[model samples]
Target: MASRSDAEAAANAATGRPRVAVFRPDDERLESAVSLLSDLGVEPVPDPMLAVEPTGETPRENADYVVLTSKTGAELAAEAGWEPGASTVCAIGPATSASMEAVGYAVDLVPDEYTSSGLVETLESEADLDGASVEVARSDHGSPVLLDGLSAAGADVHETVLYRLVRPPESGDAVDLAASGDLDAACFTSSLTVEHFFEAATERGTTDAVAVGLDRAVVGAIGEPTRETLTAFGIDADVVASEATFDALARETVAAVDR
Candidate 1:
């Protein structure tokens, strides 16, 4: 395994093209960012700012409801062997529900608000959690929001770290896109993506067209976490949906740009 300190150096050396910035660096997200950029004819210089890696550990025993919030959770559950019937499955939104369903698990409920608050509300409103055992599947880099909420609502709540999100190596061509000023708008799906965008943006020293493009060009995030990332960068998010689904994200983008 390459050392963390030098990973960026190697990645930069390998980066032959000047990329536009994208937040969060991981295999699945990276692919999605590129696909969107290509579809838009933006041809982004691909660089991720955050790296979320799965731990692959199963949830605590007696897990009766498995909670999936991000694609990371879904991907981890895909290989972590948490069976559906073992617990009533809950997804934060439809895209997650679809991912879970594609993996053969039937989702029990999805929130209407599509944020962490929304998930809690959905569970409280629809689920008879008077004595249910629940486990939230997620990366290490999360808050205690879900667990606290579920526990407060009389559900036996357990939390498991299915992955870890770390900052991607910085200081390199990924820098060129944000710094050298040779690119257009970027895209993000998570707050991590925003982290990545700012890291490169700060390095570039000017937020002008690049930042504007991200804000103006059709910002599409999968859910609240992703949208918050865009907002944190001091760029106004043009599209904010009530749900957390790629369908919503994609459809919102097409509408934002078309209008």
Candidate 2:
């Protein structure tokens, strides 16, 4: 079977499809980006620069509540047979909430902004976390925003590293397209994707070439964190989604490239 990029290229050859580099891990998660990009008439090229490895750890047994910042965290936590233990589950966004719900876990709250700060603000205003035991399920290299915020809010925060991100064996075709200037745009969903993309480019000795390609193409980020990560790599995102969702990112990427 042809690869996703090859299949999309052949299908959209006559219409001149916009090529998009999707830097997500290889899993069902990748299909979400593929479906959204295809719907927008963009050719999404898989650039699985990062792979997720589960840590096989269960959640804390005696927590009053649980917090998850990403869909992956929610999925892994459910898979690990984590008992919520009367904890009111809180997620960062609709996607994360939906993931938890699919695995028979109920999400009690989701922030308005779909971010750490947003979750913190909501908890501060709507919930009484004072003296509550909150368990945070996240990746090994996860951000400290949620942890610090919960601690400050008087919640006894316990952390469980449910998974880890590792660089993929190959960078796929993204670097090639970026170097040749064929990639029309790129969507970065996480800070890790930006870091791994640059790492992959550097490994292939195409950092400078990839930088030029990124400059030529319209770059779209899912949120502020991803945009800041891109900026750290000297590639400013041309468009950032108002909402931190793949659906929003797809629409913003198309709009950015159209302009």
Candidate 3:
């Protein structure tokens, strides 16, 4: 008469093996997850779901500040000959700060909370942004939250699109793996991965899409935004990892499933 929770806990405890679903798109994280999961007696399934594309648009006009939300976005900027020399720079997290620093840009600030909301909160409290022209280096989607917040705070904010989130050519393979139930589950590190991969599946067929999406592979959302995307797709995630990072996803995967 064990409840579902008790059954899952017992299953995990008795087996002492974690069947983990790694969703990072075959990058270094995939290797790391595979290594860590193997060391921990967990099976790591590396299935990449999204691709990041950069739009090599030069800055239309210079600004006093530039903010980068993703390490990839900052790297894209560096690739596009965009380097912050005198202007102050803001990054969303430690990974992003390292990326910017690698390109020789000194990160003026990184929010403690590591979200757009937290970034805005930090600007409101710590920055003297009055009359400062700010530029945001970003991908194709999301609101103008950073710009809007800076503008509302009396800063002149400008936006520069640096990248786009697209489906990788091999995303279909990942989808097929999920449909076949070999994936067990997939982790959504970002909303873009959810949008592009699901759109790719729907393009193939809705029934197959649902088969791939159903509880077949427990969905692991990394944060609130990713969770929102999964819910929008009519899939209630089995777990939303503690933080918006891959390490959190990997750890949560190990905790939730049994081998």
Candidate 4:
């Protein structure tokens, strides 16, 4: 049986479209990514690395501020009928803010940099966090930077695990493609995605080969944290998108392949 990558490679060979790996969760995100890549004139290998498992938890309502990190978190909070009440609603980025807004939650704050550190810095500069109660609702794999930074600023921080991002069991197709040097580029949207990609490669006993193959292909990371993860794995990213959005990451990655 021919692999998906083999069929994609064969099709792309004639169209001259670059084969770019996208590791978004298997949902509307993956569909959107595939559409975007197709519009960008690339053959997107839709290999979903992350699967969202909702924790059936919501942010505490009594906090001074409520922080939501991802669109998924915001949607889940909305579905859980969690209300901000007197708390200031903060989103980690534009997408999160939009999600909150769509759910009728007023977005009180969004960091200019759209990262954990950036949100911490923004909150410190804008709000009075001294002895304030802050509730952070996000994924289980969230960075500790936000909590640490908020605590250091004298805020009592509490975290609610809204979801767990686990790697899908059958997510190593892109790893096989990468190991065979068949991919033209890859867009890594998060640090976990990078870690999961390597985990898949390692599981297939193709870690070294995948690394070597990646050396020949363009690699793009969504932000500094993701790039740092790739660096930890000894994988040098050819492009680090200026913005942390998937749109930015995909565009930058596809452009790198064109170059």
Tens digits of lDDT, candidate 1, 74-189: 76777767676556778877767877777767788887776667788888887777788888877776656677888888988778888888766652344454444443334455
What Cα-based lDDT does every candidate model obtain? 0.63, 0.84, 0.69, 0.90
Please, what are the lDDT tens digits per residue for candidate 3 over residues 16-112? 4434555554566567766876775665545565566667874444677778887678777777777676777788878788888887778999988
Instruction: Point out the worst 10-residue segment of candidate 1 by lDDT.
Output: 171-180
Q: List the residue pairs that clash in candidate 4.
A: none
Every model's TM-score = 0.70, 0.92, 0.80, 0.96
Q: Which stretches of candidate 2 lie over 4 Å from their true place?
A: 1-15
Better of 2 and 4 by TM-score: 4
For each predicted model, how many residue pairs clash, with residues at least 3 apart or on different chains? 6, 0, 2, 0
Q: Candidate order by TM-score, highest to lowest? A: 4, 2, 3, 1
Model 1 clash tally, residue pairs:
6
Between candidates 2 and 3, name the one with more favorable lDDT. Answer: 2
Better of 2 and 3 by TM-score: 2
Best by lDDT: 4
lDDT of 1 at 195: 66
1-259 per-residue lDDT for model 4 (tens digits): 1136566567666886778999988888899999999999998888899999999998998899999998899889989998999999899999889888998899999999989999999999999999999999999999988999999999999999999999988888779889998888999999999999999988899999999989999999998889999999999999999888999999888888988
The runs of at least 3 residues in candidate 1 whose Cα sits more than 4 Å from the true structure, single-residue gaps closed, are 1-21, 24-29, 40-42, 170-175, 179-183, 200-233, 250-259
Candidate No. with top TM-score: 4
Candidate 4 residue runs with Cα over 4 Å from true position? 1-9
